[model samples]
Target: MSNTTVKRGEGILSRNRGVLVAFGIIGTWAISLIVLLLIDISQLAIGWRIAATIWQTFLYTGLFITAHDAMHGAIAPSNPKLNQRIGSFALLVYALFDYKKMMRTHWLHHQQPASEVDPDFHNGKFKNFFAWYGYFMFRYWSWVRLFGLMAIYNIISLVLKVPEVNLNWFWVAPAIASSLQLFFFGTYLPHREPEGGYVNENRAQSSNWSVFWSFVTCYHFGYHEEHHEQPNVPWWRLPELHQRKLNAD
Candidate 1:
């Protein structure tokens, strides 16, 4: 397609799709939390609980990615304040991530990817994935906040008659899994050395695989170069942008 065609298509996208999708993801996330709370985990078999927990963990990743889009101003491009508020709340819900702190770190990550300034950078600190992961948590972890979250959940379960197992299966486990997903797929795989890229050293790269696998890997965050170039595109739309680039080439 021609530039005009691309522009027109992007213009249409620039309208309500971002915010609408944001709301939709928010709705799904809210519903998932409610269901997890209401569902009595003790009644289900251990196998079923495990399966359900994994499925819910995937959904939690989606919620976090929606918030990630908002951080990039992909959602509600015309209404930044709205996007900011939504992003903050979305991060808040997903493992109680502090939006402002994340924003600062993320911006730095973009500005100096894989460099010392990038908060996520892990050069010389750890040798392997497990080691790096431990350090990553060390820099950003807040035990006080985590304990408070657990306390609140315990109270909520008492008042609402929700199962503790459900909290473990749905909330706690999923949040932990979500962290691994975000770290492994979104950060580690995309930004690691050699295969992963840096600004001056090696530089991050995108998946050459089909967009399906790319998104499957990490909500199209596997398209790391594309994302770094155009941070404003939502995760759902990264495939389109990648395709458009291919067509232009």
Candidate 2:
């Protein structure tokens, strides 16, 4: 392909198709949540109520995926301004940090994995099996930092005697919990290779199913090797790029 053709292909992957797919998925998930909320408010049985709550939590995972795509500039094409807007909206709904700042940090992770600059790394080895188990079991600690940050905002609102400030807690608490759960289950666990498990050059490539599931559940992030190799490729194109790289090999 000529340079112009490659650039056009990049534009299609980054701006047009990628953003539409991401927004469509996110909108569908949001509508599903609204429907569930309507059903829950209708005073369903106790069992159904519990199930609805679980489903709501799953929806929270979808929000994480959407925000993840925004961070990668895959939610609305290659235009940084549009990407930032989409990312900021996602952060408002799901995360408690500055979207642009977080994206910069995440980009560092793509450049170097498990390095000192990679914010995602938790390098300390568990002292024992129980220690490792505790790390996995109590993954909520990841959100403590985020909650603590938001608590500062909450405290300021209270100090100013701002009306309706209390309402923020409704989304704040669950957002923190869900964000922590995503970091633990979708990120930390997958990156860690157990003693007996197979370890590919990129741990994410260990299994085809692992990558597929990660793409579906984590917004195409499981193709870590491909992302690392081609940082400019949008998230929606990572799987195809990975396949091409594999075929080339």
Candidate 3:
């Protein structure tokens, strides 16, 4: 979307469509969670467990990404209260995130991306992934969330003896992996400064790729500029926005 599009109200999404898309993404995520609950990865071969764990991480991140959309009002544009509720629920489901805390910084990120004030972006401050990731966790880490999840795992696994829960494999492992996926694909790639003399605040990975790959990369979030431009558009519509950008180019 462009300035004209925003002014013309073309960027405002259909609430019905937004609600449906929200539920659809949430449904897919729920299915993956149920599958994890049903299967005892403990009995599976080590290789299978690893593969399942990776898949689970992707699903976990999907929920968080959806919540990000909700933060921008893309998930329920016609209803602010509904959008906030959905965003809160999505973040709560995703690693016990605080919706208001995240929204405060995230909106700031949109306002001043790649700048010193951008809470999420490390810019060039950290020399490497390890340094940057460590800083990210430090800034956003929640000790109450940490203990809460630990308590849940212990209660379910130790107290109840639910082998299928496998809290370490099913919960902790995926959340850990999801942190890497979300940070690298969503924050680092898009917000990094573009090449010299080309002044663009946001970058993308949404070229001639299938929607599957686009979503696979980062819930179609790789189209960072389009996302910021049309904050009202949901992740599912980002590729269409990206395609329009390509055609216009």
Candidate 4:
């Protein structure tokens, strides 16, 4: 396919795909969280509640994945202002994260990857899972964010009279679980040192999982190598590029 053909194809697909998907994910996440918080958990069976938690966790991860796409400017290629505004909104909804801070750090992760300079890396000292995860949390956590979330929780609970049980299970638990899901699949699995060492400039590895599992894991972010190579491809289109890479190899 010529560049002209590819660009034309992308133009058709890109018209409103990213904007729609971004809003869809955000809308779903917000609705689900609200419903879960207000629903009568006592009426639901244990298994059903667990399923709801898992579903919400997936949506929370989707929030971050949407923001990640926006960080790459994949969400709106032609409109910088709209692109970043969406990115900022996604990050705020995700966890009150600072989009500018995260965008800068993410570019560093792409630029230096597994090196010490990378903010997402293990910092060379905390190589184990728990330690590294703690380090990762420490790097991004802020008192302001903490207080902001706490205030939100209190306002919903004390002012709105929502049960703390629902808040804990649906809102807080899913957000924390989503972070673990993202880090374990997207960061640790793809970037950890393989026995043979990294084989490319991106200093990343792609998971050999099937496409379904890859998407389930972290929005195809487990295909980290392809992402580093083609950063402009949106999350929904990663599997296509991954398949192309596999066929060439």
lDDT of each: 0.80, 0.58, 0.77, 0.91
TM-score of each: 0.86, 0.62, 0.85, 0.94
lDDT of 2 by residue, 88-172 (tens): 7766555455676767777766665554455565536663434544654353244765676668657645674433322232233
The candidate with the higher lDDT, 2 or 3, is: 3
Per-residue lDDT of candidate 1, residues 1-249 (tens digit): 899999999888669798878788788878978886787666889898887788778778888898889888988888899999989888888767888888888888888887677777676667478887777777788897788788889797898778787787788898889788888877777677773334443356667779777766677887777788889888888888778877887
lDDT of 3 by residue, 1-249 (tens): 888977556434443677767677678777876667667665799888788788888888878987898888877777899998888988887778899999999988888776778777674668467787787788888799989877877787777676634667877788889989888877776766556622565433333557788788778877777887878788888999998998999
Structural RMSD, model 2: 7.1
Name the runs in model 3 displaced over 4 angstroms.
Answer: 1-14, 201-210
Pitting candidate 1 against candidate 4, the one with the higher TM-score is: 4
Question: In lDDT terms, how accurate is model 3?
Answer: 0.77
User: Which run of 10 residues does model 4 get worst, by summed lDDT?
Assistant: 8-17
RMSD to the true structure for each prediction, in A, is: 4.5, 7.1, 6.3, 3.9
RMSD of 1: 4.5
Q: What is candidate 4's lDDT per residue for 180-245, written digit by digit as tens?
A: 999998888888888998899989999888999988888999988999999989998989988999
TM-score, cand. 2: 0.62
State the weakest 10-residue window (summed lDDT) of model 1: 195-204
Ranking by TM-score: 4, 1, 3, 2
lDDT of 4: 0.91
Maximum-lDDT candidate:
4
Q: After superposition, how far is residue 19 of candidate 3 from its true place, in Å?
A: 2.2
